[model samples]
Target chain A: MRTDLCDLLGIDHPIVGFSPSEHVVAAISRAGGLGVLGAVRFNDAAELDTVLTWLDRETGGRPYGVDVVMPSTVPTEGLPEDLNAMVPSGHHEFVERTLLRLGVPPLSAAQDRPGVLGWLHSVARAHVEVALNHPIRLIANALGPPPPDVISQAHDRGVLVAALAGRADHARSHVRSGVDIVVAQGYEAGGHTGEIAGMVLVPEVVDAVHVPVLAAGGIGSGRQIAAALALGARGVWMGSLWLGTTEYQSGHALREALLRATSSDTVRSRIYSGKPARLLRNRWTDAWSAQGAPAVLPMPLQNLLVSAAHDRLMASGDPTVVPMPVGQIVGRMNEVRPVAAVLSDLVTEADETLGRLHKLL
Target chain B: MRTDLCDLLGIDHPIVGFSPSEHVVAAISRAGGLGVLGAVRFNDAAELDTVLTWLDRETGGRPYGVDVVMPSTVPTEGLPEDLNAMVPSGHHEFVERTLLRLGVPPLSAAQDRPGVLGWLHSVARAHVEVALNHPIRLIANALGPPPPDVISQAHDRGVLVAALAGRADHARSHVRSGVDIVVAQGYEAGGHTGEIAGMVLVPEVVDAVHVPVLAAGGIGSGRQIAAALALGARGVWMGSLWLGTTEYQSGHALREALLRATSSDTVRSRIYSGKPARLLRNRWTDAWSAQGAPAVLPMPLQNLLVSAAHDRLMASGDPTVVPMPVGQIVGRMNEVRPVAAVLSDLVTEADETLGRLHKLL
Candidate 1:
């Protein structure tokens, strides 16, 4: 498990667990792997500050990182309120009509609206400021190459900057932008991703750039971890595998759905976010894909248009319509276990798989 | 370099080279890898018989395989002439207009019309009959599960049957339908393919089916072979990597284009075979993807519609508009080398890669 990545990150293992839950992040670090907190859901710097403080106390000064979604290209420019007006009325009507036809109820005024960054560059820069303020070991941009200033700021704070790339060209761009680590995420990964698979992209990115690369997408077990390293990645960056961990606070209905879904149950669509993201195939995705449906908008507008519909679905407690970003590895996540137990199984299985390979030689 | 797949198929190495030329196939088998002859180009049993007999004498008793394209679901049923009638005039007009605009010349009357199987089941059955008569070690179906009867027939002749699958469910279906091996191909693979990537699909298929799995798609190197093995595949099935080999009879212009093209120069479009296949992005693909382009026809009809245009493009001697099916690995294939040298490099590189992994452990 110990490799150049481990030495660089000062971790016992090269596995990096990504989650929005502070508990899962802390647990993964305590279990000898690097844990990264996804801060895209944070509404403001103050909310992020509180979460970082809690993570620092929970891990007891152990190394952890922060992940933010800052796409290299912004579809629109302006404040959230200004961008809200840019969405077409036809898209909004389509969402409403589809939800109404599906018998999904609307949300109450008292229910809280989920915070969406909406691909706004200003919102992402605020995330960078908050992440840099913490004693983080690494900062990763999920959508694309982090802006040059963000990379410089993280470096100034002695924090390594990483970016997720789906293509070899994107990985090279990240390296040129001063990223310290390149995370090659495949099409099977949750959230926004490129068409290339991890098996092909890892080796391509490794050859394209001089920096260490982390293999991501559809990775869950120790065997996959070994496969990533064999593909020339310094380590594996996993997200979907952490969604069902006991430490994470996934809703009961959503958790059960996650445990039951197969890899084929997911579809990559731009309905949830403006970019193509893999989420569990539900009525929502089918509605958007149905014939005569309005064309999906790009980036900020699409993200804005769907936010209200998502709130109504969540408030109504309709498990089938709720969007959950997950990778194809979700098929194997059939149980809820402690973070330590998951990490132990991964490490053990990877060792056994490697030993088996040695026997083959 | 050695695994159960090698022993099962009685080959010296686990690498399987896929090529249309008899010379490349014979050379690959002689160099310790399995050379699978692509027999889809043959119009009838007599044509296939002639090729198989030539391969038998060329390999000097070495084991090789035959590849046929028999999609599990036929888009339309009938003879080649009947299917040709089913193609709409609009699609025919689109093909002609696109070709004429691209400045492609008409095929010469003296040049033989290229044989196209056109996804008809009867043609595939004839291919199987021709293949089973030879001393073939394996029979691979490129599009879908070889029909159960085909698998049984191959088994009766003591030949193993393999099917290419782009999804885990597809692999499981292949095994249930009596395929002895499943070739897990990713989106980056050449020819007809699904959206799932090799990195994620290989392990999923390996876990879903009881039979040995061969990882395909963007695999073109020894390191990728090791990665497939680490992901639990018994072997690696490669196609695009063999296109640039010295033994392949690719035209001078096509060969030069292949050597110079990058990974990003390919696009998966339905223009070639009426199915989503990765081919070198050229004027033909661009024309079909352009605004106001007619909707591409399905399967056999689409395949039939494109055959004549492809013939014209090939006869024109213009490389820019020619359709060449290849994987993203084309970027790495910068040179033309003998089949033996390519096989040797793969085996040696895999051995060194395994050694490096051992050191990491």
Candidate 2:
């Protein structure tokens, strides 16, 4: 099952898991696959330093990576006094009214808010600097191409740089900007995405760029992994599949909703983060897309607008209104297994699928 | 390279080409594939009968299929005196205004108008009856599942029945209704399509149904065909790839436009067919989706509203205003080739791709 990607990343397998959990990162790397920790949630550099130190000790010196949300552009001026001020009044009213209609209680003032930093370029650079200090094998930009200096910095440190692209032209631009790898994310992916699907986007990106491509979105099983390889991608970058792992930090209510949901239960809406991200459709998404709903704002403003509301919704523990970023592959994630078990199953299934095809030849 | 689909369809390869041209249909079948004639353009049973007879003679006893746009449900009681009467005034004005702005001239009164059928159940049934009279190996419905009686009728005549679906649940419904094959058409596909991409939709449909599954949408090369098989699809069903074939009846201007257009040049809009179809972005599509554009009408009405205008635009010999249904794969189609040459290239490329993967094993 080893491909050029395994040789490049110095991993036994080509499957790369992206998650925000340190436990998942260590487990996936120890299981012979690459685990990329999403560092977008850390607002404090000291806190990120602490997390990376813990991850370093937990991985037992195995290779792992860090992913930051460094979008190519951000609003530079007109900084608001408070993040909440950036949100429109209509959007706030819509969220509050919908929660009220859904019979959800307000959160206590003492509840901790969700972290928000990666959307800003300055904060993301801090994260990149912290990540580079550690023995990180790779650094990935979640939103777009990393700045030229950041790519050069990673290169200078002998670390590979990867960027997520939803379109072929984006992949070409990333390659032109000196990215070592391109993750072709389809519309069915959990996070920010473009309109193209993985099946079409993978080959297009692979053809458009000279760099190795990693196929993402709606990839859960060995058959899907094989499909990605067949489409000319060197590896598969998975995020949603790891959400159902026992090591993830998902609450019981969220896990239950994910297990019970079908592929059709997800929708690509701008309600969660300014961009169109595939999320589990719940009362919140429905309310935002419903008639008379206000248009969603873009980028940092949208992230800031929903940060407090997301914290409150999570605190409320009302499953119907909680937001969960997941892909259509959630349909196949019917159980919570250990990370090791998930990796073993993927390898075995892929082997059997390849064996079946060999019989055809 | 042979799979269960080849045995079921009794073809040399699992590739199936769908087009409205008899010349292309016969050429594909002769080149060791199943050629499905798009019968939606045939309003008169006599015309379809003549075409089928010619195809039969051309293929020299090889198996072929017929495709009709017979949506399972339709408004039967509200039959209009003429097709134009069913179209709303606003939609007609929008089309006329857009064409005038593009400097397109009206067609002569004596010019023959394009046939508008299949959107109506009555006309589609006539198409099915005429098709069954010939030695059609398969009968496929382009929209929705064929009615239970229609399936039984095809079964009684020993002709297999297939239907196109964009969602997993829709595939299950088609299987429940006795479809022998399910064509999973993704959002990147030409003609009427659902929101899901072929990569995600194929595996989902393959898991949901017991019948053979054909992957469609954005498939133009052998690598894509291999990807479909890896995703658990039995074969590949193609539509847009045949549009630029020398055997097709497309005008030189239209073929030139298709050759020059990129994947990003297509848009999914509900202007031409009432259903969201991925078409080459042109002056007509841009006008319809432009700001202050009127809302598109329902299925048959939308088709009727654009029918005469479509004829005039094609007659005008101005490709910019003409609406052409194509997939994102159009970006790869930079040249026109004979249908036989295209099919031969696909087989050779697929063989090479499979051999390369075997070496990896």
Candidate 3:
């Protein structure tokens, strides 16, 4: 195995495992791939620091990274300074109307506090800056190209810079901006992405940009990994494939559902984020897609409202109207194995595919 | 305006207009584009010669091209020794059973000749030999990569070669095999294509192959032509957009329906060539998709069965089951104008689109 990615990242396969769990981040890095703890829903900068510190200690000096959602474009900075002031009358009223229509209880006065957007960029930057103060190997912008200062600062710290492009144009633009690697994401990817399917998008981005291309989106197995390489992607950036591993913090319901699903499942919808994103199509996503309903607000505002519903539904177990951002790759997340085992199998499968492809020539 | 594909075939634009009518082909080439007469169901050499001669005179020294379906993979050597030796008795009985069930007419004894697999390699090679004796500027293999001898001979004659690929892997393979140009076709394209869509597939193919990429699929207007160029394609390949112009040979029913379509009205189904091909979906195509209908046979075999049925249905004005391979671009085939009007509008549209794209920067 070429474990240079491990040596470079201070972990394994250059695979950046994305998760919401401190345990996963530590375990993945210990196994040789750096685990990126998602900080989207973290309520405060101080709380996030403890988790980062915990990850550092838990991994025994192995490197790790942090992820954040900084919109390439923000609608307005009308966000409130005080947490209390962030609550909107019409927005919450819309949420209340939806809950009433669904015959569910509204959030109580005690649970009326807003989300973490007021300081999301600053907090994420603080985390990145703090991680760089250590031996971290990379800093990636999840939503788009990272602001220029972040790119320069990462380079100054000898960390690599990466951005995701849903189409070839975006990938070329990233290369033009001097970004080191472009993640050519397909619609099969989790989170926010445009409508282009993965099998076609990878090679397009690889061809469009001079920078090394890492194929992301629905990559979960060795066979898929092989397919990506054959399509000319140098390496793979897996997200959903990591969500079902033992190290992940996925709830039993979603995890089990993921493990049982086949490739036929999953659909791209905009219910979770304001933008179109691929997820397993369930009643919640379906309900919003049907009939006369207000279209979801574009990002930032939509992200603000949906997080509150997710918080409530997790406790209520009312999955009918609550959803998660997962990818079509969830269908292939059939078992809970160690992160290292998954990585090992993926590389092995790729080897076999290359061997078979060679014989045909 | 350059009418023939220059340098390769001593013509104007490398644009080859594919139409069922020799008259239309002649007019298109005379008007400054290479008019390619489709030889799909050409009965024999004598009949083809008549059409070619007529085309030569009508175009007034303007060069033209010929398109033949010489697929890379074919199951058998095509037609058997004779009518008796060709189709199996069992297969013949099955056809009779189907025709009786559908309440169709029995075959006349004199007309029991084998179907037109007259374009089999040996025959097409003969046709090419005849064509080499003529003034064709380019030679295209519609189904896949043209044979090595076909490529070499065309090159020897100083004729250009073009092959179509719906995927990046295929496109790269074409370039590696010494192809001069690649037609990057998307699923929205008429004729055979994979499930990968155009907006995604075009750029991928462009990136994967070094040869100049011609974007094909649902492009019909100036805006779409500009979009293809923006996506990194060198030029554009059109098929369906020309089918409804007054110079083309479409009947009233087909032309009216095409004029009324939108971008969303087409479907990719293997009903036509036993290969995944996009066309305007209708009752005939839908009927076959519904159940356990025997899969369509590849190439000449499927062509053998469907063509006869289509002629009969079309004669009776009930072609609800006939599929005319059309692109999503059929939406723009909203008028019946002269071929010159269509060609000039496209160039103008592309120029305007480039202007708008620059404004975004």
Candidate 4:
């Protein structure tokens, strides 16, 4: 199961775990796999800096990474109120009406919303600045290639820059933009993804770029990791598999819903963050796809438009109306295991799977 | 490179080439792989009988198979004219207007249409009757499991029954219905496919059903075959790779379009057969997807309604309007080679890939 990626990333295994939970991130790093903390949930740079500082201490000198959302196109930058004002009333009404109809209760007090300003270039650049101030070994961008300045800044700090790509051309362009690694995220992946599946996209991206490629999407078990490597991927980047871990801080209702989900329980809809993100097919997603639903807003506006609604739904503790981004691998995430146990099982199973495949030759 | 599937099917390699061209089928079998001929094109029993007779002689006693379409639900059965009259005028106008807008010329004197009766139980039963009289080694159904009677009939003649499934539950049901082999067709596969991608679907199906599973969809190389084996599939069933072989009878224009395409050039749309089938994205598919286009009718009607337009597009010699059912693997079909060479390359590359993976262990 070892590859060049393990050496490059300074990890014991080639597996990379991605999650928004800082506990999960530190736990993964301590477990010998690279844990990447998703920074989209942090709008304040100081808050992110505090978390990274804690991560640096919690990981016990092990290497970890930070993932920031930087869309290729520069979006309108503002505070939460300004972005909320930009959202169309029809779209807002649709969300409100649908949430109300789905029995999602409202918040008594207005929750402090961050507006997903982290998706904007200005904030993501701040995230990079905060991330570099720590001992992070890798800096990852979600939607596109980090700016040349960001790439050079990370390089100067001796950190590798990785960008997620769904297509071969995107990977080549990422390499041209000076990225060190390309995460080939497939259509079955959570968050924003491209149309090609990992089985095809991984090989295509590997052929297109010289950098190490980590196959993403629909990869949960050891067999899937071996299959990804056989398809020419140097490693695997998994996010959905971590959502059910004990380290993931979420309500019991959401964990229960995820445990009950099958692979078919997810749908790729633009309703999430105005991009085609694979999300659980719950009442929230289904309502947006229903007849006469207003067209979703773009980029940060969509995220801002739905942030308050998300908070309300979370506050309500209603699983059916809660919004969660997950891949088809959710079907296989049947149990809640500790982070150490899950990582141990992944490595052991992969080693056994590789040995079995060797005998086939 | 061999698995239990090879010994069961009596082939040298665990590869199954699926094509509607008898020449391609015979070439695959003679080259030491099993080739399955698609029977949907032969609505007439006599026509299918003639082709099977030629295939039996052409392969020189090698093993081959036949694929028939049998939807789980019973569809309305009638002659071409009788079914054609049931099509709404608006739907007819949409097809006519679409073809006219796309510059597809009218066909010459209706072209002796057969009305896709092959999708019905009655016609498919006749197809099985004609196929069983020959030396066919296997019988495969595309849409669903073969009925109990059909499975028993094949078993009585010492023939194996295989069915395609996109989900673990579907594969289990197929095995329960007496299917010997289950083909885990992924979303990247050509023609009608389910939502699960191959990387996740293959392992899920293998764990669910005790029968041997053949990995299908997005497989066009030996490296993919090795990956499939790593994911626990006993064999690989390929369809799109054969479309570009020299034995395929498609027009030069359509062939050129296929060669020029990349992995992103295909879309899963119901316009092809009212089922979500992957097809080459072209002007025809684009028009049907555009706004103001009528909703695609259910199967058999959708096929009949667009059959003449498909013929007209073929006659127009316009690559942009021709309808072709292909998978994401079309991107790798760069040149037209003999079927024997393709099979040889697949086997050689697979062996080399297996050897390399063995060293990784």
> Residue A320 in model 4: shift from native, Å?
1.4
In model 3, where do residues sit more than 4 Å from their true spots? A1-11, A81-94, A100-120, A319-321, B1-361
Candidate 3's residue-wise lDDT over B186-226, tens digit each? 76677777645555566667768877777787666655555
Backbone clashes in model 4, listed as residue pairs: none
Per-residue lDDT tens digits of candidate 4, residues B70-141?
A: 886768777778878888999999988988888777766756454566766788889999999999999999
Cα RMSD, each candidate: 1.9, 1.8, 15.4, 1.3
User: Deviation in angstroms for B209 in model 3?
Assistant: 32
Error of 1 at B164 (Å): 1.7
| Kept native contacts, fraction for each prediction | 0.65, 0.48, 0.01, 0.68
Report clash pairs, candidate 2.
none
Per-residue lDDT, model 3, residue B39, is 73
Point out where model 1 deviates above 4 Å: A73-75, B73-77, B112-115
- Model 2: DockQ vs. true structure: 0.60
User: Between 2 and 4, whose TM-score is larger?
Assistant: 4
CAPRI category for model 2: medium
**CAPRI category for model 3:** incorrect
Interface RMSD of 2: 1.6
Model 2 chain A scores worst on lDDT over the 10 consecutive residues at A75-84
- Give the TM-score of chain A in candidate 1: 0.97
What does candidate 2's lDDT look like per residue over B218-318, in tens digits?
88888788778878888899999999899998886688789888777888888777888888899878888789888888777777777777777777777
Q: CA lDDT of A335 in candidate 1?
A: 93
- Give the whole-model CA lDDT for all candidates, comma-separated: 0.85, 0.85, 0.65, 0.89
Write model 1 residue lDDT over A275-344, tens digit each, in one string: 8889888887898888999888887778778877877766666667777888888788889999999999
Best by DockQ: 4
